[model samples]
Target: MDGRAFLASLRTTAVTRVEAGERVAQVSRNMGVSRSSVYEWLRQARSEPQKLQASPLQGRPSALSPDGLHDLATALLAGPESAGLTGRLWTRELVNELVSRDHGVSLTLTSIGRLLRSLGLWPRHSLVTWPDGSARLWKQRYAYIKEKAREQDALLMRGGLVDVGALLPRSSLPAAPFGFHLAYALIPGGPLLFRAYSGPANAATFLDFATGLVAETGRATCLITAPHPVFDLDECARGLAGLPLTVWVRSDGDARALRPAPAPATASAPDLRPAVLGGPSTGLWTMDRLAGHLSALFGHPVSTGEAEVLLSAQNLWPEGPLPPVLPPGSPAVGRWCHDVLPLFQAEAGPGAAVRFVQEVPLPGGRTLLLAVSPDQERRFAWYEEARYQGRMRATTLADFTRRLRQDLAEPLCLVVTDDSGWRSRDLDATATTVGDAFFCTWADGCGERVWRIPERDPVQALCRRHFHQGRGPAPAGTASLEMEHPPRGPVGTADRQVRIAAAREHARRQPLSAGGRLRELVLAGPPALLTTRTLTALLSRAYGRPVDADRAVAVLRDEGLWPEEFPSVEPGPWEHETLPLYLAHAGAGAAVRFVAEARLGGDLSLLVALDRAGETRFAWYPQARYRGRMRATTLVSFAGLLLDDANGPLCLVAADEAGWKSKELAAALARRPVLVVAAGVPYLCAWPAGCGNRAVMGDQCRTHARRSRRLAVHRARSGPLLDAVRAASAELAVARA
Candidate 1:
């Protein structure tokens, strides 16, 4: 029977035993099952006896056997290249082809998809890979340090250097900013220690702080800091020598996992209720006055509405109803209903000569003059005039008014304007010469007559709409008339020529293919890596149509822009040796650790050793150096340099990998008590207190492989789920509005 049938048979036996007068607890113990499970089986047998029976398996059998499926999964993990596919990505079609060629099983695309999902494989867009087992390493190192601190009865602290300029409030910043500050806090509810320094953080400043820390502690203390350059300098090492301090510099990933202690409570502000209620009864308490008073007391900006809420919470309301807040606009908008609108309506009779004018200053020393007539057959004219040195000439306005009168054939023009610049004597005289009346719209608070323009003037609204449409992309089969030639008047001949030349050049260029354009963009900029999703978006924008990512990849591949293989290094033979060694060295008692420079793909080149107590300590090079090349002399020099910082004996180990099979490396290590061994070494599993099995994969044994696969699937699905949730929240907010 299969695994599922075996479990069903076991459950049926348990229920049968319980029905034969056997105690549920005793049966559970005998069968190594929980009492709850035995009771549940009994209940199931009473209600649905068929559930306890091991029925024959249903459905069609899979085309591939178990070993065949395993081979396909291994091939998929090796990627599409192993199947002789031409592209890096694996679609259902590729997987189907691979299955047919390898196992002689011709499955449909849907079946291939089911097969891939069953093996826990999914499509990814980007090429970046994260190290596995980093979280496991972090937990192990953290627990080791905490145990060491507890045994020594030393005060444990966790902190690092920070840029004080970034953390301080704007009001507290000095006239000239200084950058670095050292801050450490005792863990599990202890006082914080902070020291600020001027200028950037350097070896000298760090050494000074270390001296002060030694003097202040005067006893054994364990301080954990992030791996920083200042701590590794020779000056810092000399200054910290023979001190009663044990400093541990953790990797960036591990250091970020440390949780900060809760901060002490800040002193509360003095109560302002007595001061506000005792006096200030001479006049009504306005919200604006209260807001200003509260802002001063709290030392931050506060609005009138916030002040009203605060006062209401304290059982203090304003004397009367608050004034309604006005909408943001020009001052003339307030008097539009009562002042100037009636005059315009009175003049809008049959054959009336009424015109609305709007003057807007634009960037690049230019002004837009727009005029519109309010009638069923509305007529409008606009002119863009370039001013010299930002000064508007009266002649430009005169010319626009003359053109409007001639175009509309209105003899007596009465124009309404809001700009105070219309009060120019030259403009008024020109208007009088043309039999036109230019009325200025300004509402003075007096018992006299006033004229003001409405907030949404017809001419200004039309001008804004026209400008916005002009900025957008033109529709297909449509062309702008102004592109061929510049508008008449004011613009110099040289400027007109330049505009025409630019338009001609833009028209002469032929459209490029999506692949060609994408290649150009990739070659032009810093984002050297482009995912399939990013490629689809870029190509769709370039071609003004939706382009599928698979199609884009095909086109780029045909053009030799994309490679057939994914950008990843194959797992080298040394990773198995390096990973276990690294984990072994990361245990409780090692005083210093060093990692050799070797090419161990998928993980950093790490070195691990065990002392007499069988405790492990680990050290590794930077993750970026996983694929980097280093000479034997370079490795030996670095190892010698790290020996200066070692508090106890140091040992180096060589693997059977190609990089470690060097005569020079072996000779150099022979000078020290280093061991160079080949394969067949029995190493413990990298899992936390894992089963005593030899590792077959990178660092995990076969027992924990299924658990690791489940965790990997969970990590893959979590990111997309979080992104979907955030998108839904934003969409909900927009819908509510």
Candidate 2:
């Protein structure tokens, strides 16, 4: 018997003997076990006799030995390419081949799957590819911080600043018109020290709070704070000189570790009982009573403004009518509708144009200026202008107005804008010089409408919605207003051509890197599929590295490929009618096409094709079974299935690596024009004269390009550590640059 069964048999025998009225001591002596063990066994037998039963033996031994399994795991970690596999993904067939080749164990695909599962390995779908050493670096940093905190017996605290205006009553907000900044330091499971200050949150306020905290605690404080401009490290170090304090700037990975735990519920100090504060004869709290209560609680003379802020923080409202909650910009909107809109309407006469101007802030310090006429035709034009480094200047508005004037041929134009920045004296001077009337009005709650234009034309709403969705072209009905260029004549076309040439020259000078390729694609046109995921996949394939979606977007902005603005519209639930309309459009055989491509990897096959409209479409399904073998359907069959109801002749393109070589499928498609073309494999690396491995970075294979990148990061991180170590050993001062 196995060792487990033998032990179980002994336990069962001991329990039987003990239950038969024999002394526990005698049973233990006979069995050579302790009396306590016999007694425990007897008790277990009385409760659950099945507890003494032995567990069943394991199933038959695995086909591969333990050492072979270990080697298999190591191979998996090294990736499929390391084992001479074609693709990066690990499939059952690949693992079976790996085991048969390396371990000399020929296993079935099913058996290989079982073995992989036993080793705690499973197939996962992830678009993000994390760096190799980032997790290890994060763990090391966390361990170092924890060790230092433990050695110094320091209180690990996190500091934050909150705007008091968010919690204060609207009536009291004017006392600190810009809102009072409340700087707070929180000790996990300890006291919370906070102070209210005026003006913007800056380094001086943070330093003052930290200094006071150090003075109060008289203990070592390790503060974890976000890397905001308010926490300038050099300024903080100088301001907190000779204090037992250390500041750590938090990184994205360390957010969870630096998050403060909830403090204990038990009160650490005397509670300020609000009921004990007697009110006036009317039983209402006056400002004096509230201020006096706060003064006593904080042990300092509290002003009325401070008391109001404190009352709001504690959610203590005086007995009175509740303040009405109005939507943002409502008052301004009301004023504009009552007073300013009429003046613009009166100015808009025959041959005269009234354009509602809207300014949208975009990524990368740019602004989009849109001017749409209020008339039924909805004549609109937009201009993109770069902003100054810090703020929007008058020159940007002037340039946009100039461009608008060149586009619209109307002699007299009245421009209505909601942007307060248009009220600048410089902008007014420019408006007077251009002879364009500028009227600044208040925007509506949605910010898309100053006057209710959507109610007049439903097409305006649809266009705005499509632009905000950032999906397809503006719905079928909407059209851009075309106008003849002003008598400036041939200059416009020449200027545009010159600009295009300049852009081409700039692109030519740019190196053929991932960013350069992305810029080129964007310059060609705004991609039909502009989603982050799609861009990430495209860039990853082009660059031969794991590119994150967010990183792709950031690159677009940095390369000036991103648009200055897109319409902002809140998404609504999909209407029931949308699906039917989409299917009918596709069924008409005018909007979509059928293209078949061979599978790249996995059980599923992918078919990517471009439609007649030049928009990319993808269709995928499990590889079809035909005569006991996997085969894709003929192009004729797929076209008929997709466009069965259409009356027109269907156009089908069959592009595959090998599957479409059948003469029968070719003959079927021969009734019409057939073009057979060979396409390169897009999945492989594009690097010239390099190993055609899977690309994980930009256009280059990971094996050939990522090694240098990893080394560069390692050197950058290790340089500081090496310098500190050498300086400490030689007793030399290390100057930081």
Candidate 3:
């Protein structure tokens, strides 16, 4: 074969093989070529050049060929309405079903999609329906109306105003699928005004629209609309009754005004029209922009958000003057209400805005400015509770206020509290340090209260509770500092003894005081002993003071001497002595026993073992799992254990059954996560395992054991020697278990 012809044949074979999902290696073997050569030829065919098909062999066609299916789908989609179908769009399944039913052409759901793509009749899945009407129709109608208005030489200027009556739609917004109707009017220079009425729009809605319209333009004019019940005489009278603007309502055969008509203008009515005004029916967005436009029209900047607030206030008290909530003779506070009060209530909740005034220096020199809302008072209350009652340290109110003043860069004014506490004041205060006096209130409280003591310094501020004393109330005065008696002796042994006696007397007053009599009982006696000596001491000396049996028991439990079952042993000579002690306990019971070694002079080593009663024999290990597999060794001292290479070499070969069940690691570490329990008070600690020396996984684990020989006297007094022995015993138990 010629080289070019050979290459063309090879290319065809490679493409066929790839389509069959056969690997290059398999293809290479079948084609009698090296894998690399087959891959190279395939790559060349794909990237370098197109191969010529010898006979242009078209493979066996499907029952319905691609082109044939395309024609069928196109015919189906041309217009389902022609066939009296209700749906506007054709789904894949629908098209397939239609083709099969009409032409007896069966097509798979997947094949129908490919066929549709070929005909360019793809599905349009998402069609937005607007509050007023369908999005497409709205855009079309709006564009047409805007164009016609422009053609009539009526153009709205940036700052111009237009009295927008209502563009009442035939269908109620909510009744339709879209769920809202829009009312709007063209403003000359102001923003486009639109109000969304959820139900059918009528005269009341129109009146609302007109009132808002007048508030924006500072005057009202004739409202041109189509014949609708909203403009019936009664409805028109209701809407125009008390409005400041002269509402000349015009429709078919009905036109009237609140007052006598003015003389015909000397010239024709000024060409006042709108350019582009598009928004939802709520009119919130449109009104906001309109306010800004009004400001520009009048040569001053007006905030639409601000105008909305004022408009809301007017609506809230249509007939009455502004509310008298702000105290008399406080114009700064009153001015705060002009925009902020309504805004806060509308955005946050009712009764949420409270203004505060602070004197400040402006470009005009020293002046008093109102720092409206602040959360200090509420914050102070919380701080008081936590610091005194809850015994927690929290930031003070004064500090928070001072920081706020620094942050807002102004004397700091009003604050709005949205119900988050403590940190709320801090957040609000941060705004003031930047130098603008603004509104901010505590997160917990709804409104602001005037700063009672205006003075910043806590000390200089007069106490509201006791004005005559002329003092701040913080840390209220306590009992007299006067001593009943002087020191009994000079600074020597006698004085020290006196102090020690006094301390003991104070402790003896409370049965459950940390160093009191109850502690002594739990540390020294069993539960029965608690029923005897401890109870008697408590009843006689400190019964009326405070009783905490749990605390006392916890102390003993930490010492590994608490009675798991009551009626425990009395104190012995080795009560607090260190010894070569082996700790053994039954899993089902909480009692712990320490068996001392027979060897003398060597301080007792601490070792823990498991009880074998009913599967009670302790499975001992350095880890906290109860493993069945066991390994044993002799005990060693703390230093000796550390020095041993066998201990160092011990690593996780693999976990065993016994290792998984063992609780030794947990007990040895003395760490327990919080859990729910029944009956007993939560014993946060596990057994005699004290929260260990070092924390593991964010918790304390392992016992504290220290070895030092710095001072012989010190060494003799501390239980270090005993601790070493205990460590040795622990190592021995781990080895044996």
Candidate 4:
């Protein structure tokens, strides 16, 4: 070979020898080159292993043979629908299943996707966001509508009115979506005038359409409509300046006089033109949009997860005799007619939309097949009739299982309740036997067991076992079956009994009017707002027995726990302590004195004072000898019959100099003769009452504050400690002198 060939041959020989574990010395000797040459050859081979393996040999043969690829690509190009797939889109799992069935070789979704990509097929999707009145600046536009509705009604009532609006959905027509704003005018008794332009629902298009409609309608015409871009702006207003046309934008739900007809040009034989109001149906989408806007005005606004209880609930009240309960524009509250009721009664029933699709009928009634479905927002269950005042949310397993299957085709099994930790015995059930499928019940809320049914796919079967596998109940378990699976009476019976017992005892020990007691319960509560559930729960715990929420509300209302009306007069600013400090100084157990109205031989009702955030109580001044005490019963009525006419209102004065507000407190005290001695000081008050609901003194959490005095000094003073000190000082001084 030539020199290049010889060098290449030598390098190959050296690299092969080195890689074969031959010593560098042996490789160099065999190749007739230096040891350095062998090392260099090996290093090149190691640096670029790909180059060493870069022979024209085939890599692992394609998973599919040439024929298989040809056939597979053909099948895919035909589209998923042609292959009998349920969904329009070709998902990876579907593709995998299809390929496995056709080729008799299972391929993962990932691999099939790669094969499809090589065959030049790709996936496409459609995405959309719904457009509505709730677009940007909705609040501003809504406000504008509310303000201008009256003017629009006047214009519409005049004669020739042009109403403009965009059609329901965007279309794929040349203009493509955000359909044209159409200005249609039905002149009373005259020819119908209409104009349509394809484009965005914007100010420019609106102005153009309005101009065209005005031209067709002639000089004297009025256009009234919901506020849109062109109509609401100054530019459109300027465009109509020269014309005899007036534009009025309607406000939300503005009540306006009916538009009277204008005389036709000749009234020649009925002008057989199409009437816009009596035209073909705008279809469900348009009606849905109408319902949405109307509902907002009627208080059944479009919000996610709200239930449809009645037509008033959805605000789809049509043109008919309005339901007796519905008041004009307002939807009826807490009541609805059945005709307009929603398929989902969750909002009406206070639970959520649930489906008990599969049913088995018996002479008794029907039984429901349940499968656990996870939902984040609502609690759904299948039951027949709601139990007494029973919350739709709260249901027994028996009831849920007994609901007659409403829809038949569903094959899903119901999974029990979720992670509230507070489980209802009825909602939480045991492993039940229903047909071939075990209605499995497991206590662990963390694991969700769905699709555990016998899987045809081995891979799917393995996954089923992996996810649903969990520990079963013990053969010798000591779990509380009685609590978990209670016999049918009512739910929460034990809880109610405990609560009733506790509450009755507390009420007997400390009596207050029913309403007052409930108010106190509400005021002293930890939660900021009281819901029936929370209140009922609270009442149950406080008293012994079941606390029905509706009953509690009724009791509170009856008690006239109404706020006291403050006298039109405002309290003048004077020395005063708020709740905390007031509770401290001149508080309970503090020395107090009541001053008399008359300077000489007057009646002084000295009493111990009690105050709360809402109300105050007074008792005989502690250690008042024989003075009578005041009771909580007459707290508001206990105004001083005599000394009440104060320089201002009788002030709550502190006896201690530290606690007292000013010299006014002392001067006022000196004016009266009764003296109170407490902790070596005296607090004085004329005991004015009926100022506010504060009597309305609270105790429970706030109603949490209860009165008690500070800790007392316990140490005894030495009899002669002061005298002994003085004598010692004198003796020491004399000795020093």
lDDT of 2 by residue, 168-257 (tens): 111211121112344556666654454444323444555656776776567998876655544432333444545677777655545322
Model 4 lDDT tens row, 69-129: 5455444434355667543334457677677777777887668656754432321111111
Q: What's the distance in Å from true for residue 722, model 3? A: 31
TM-score of 2: 0.19
Best by lDDT: 1
Candidate 4 is scored at a TM of 0.15
The parts of candidate 2 lying over 4 Å away from their true place are: 1-139, 150-153, 161-182, 196-200, 232-234, 253-737
Model 4 scores a C-alpha lDDT of 0.33
TM-score of each: 0.17, 0.19, 0.15, 0.15
Q: TM-score for model 1?
A: 0.17
List lDDT for all candidates, in order.
Answer: 0.44, 0.44, 0.33, 0.33
lDDT digits (tens) for residues 37-151 of candidate 3: 7677667667864543343436864445433443353344233444455443334565666777765788887787565433322222211211243556645644654554456
The clash numbers for all candidates, in the given order, read 6, 11, 76, 41
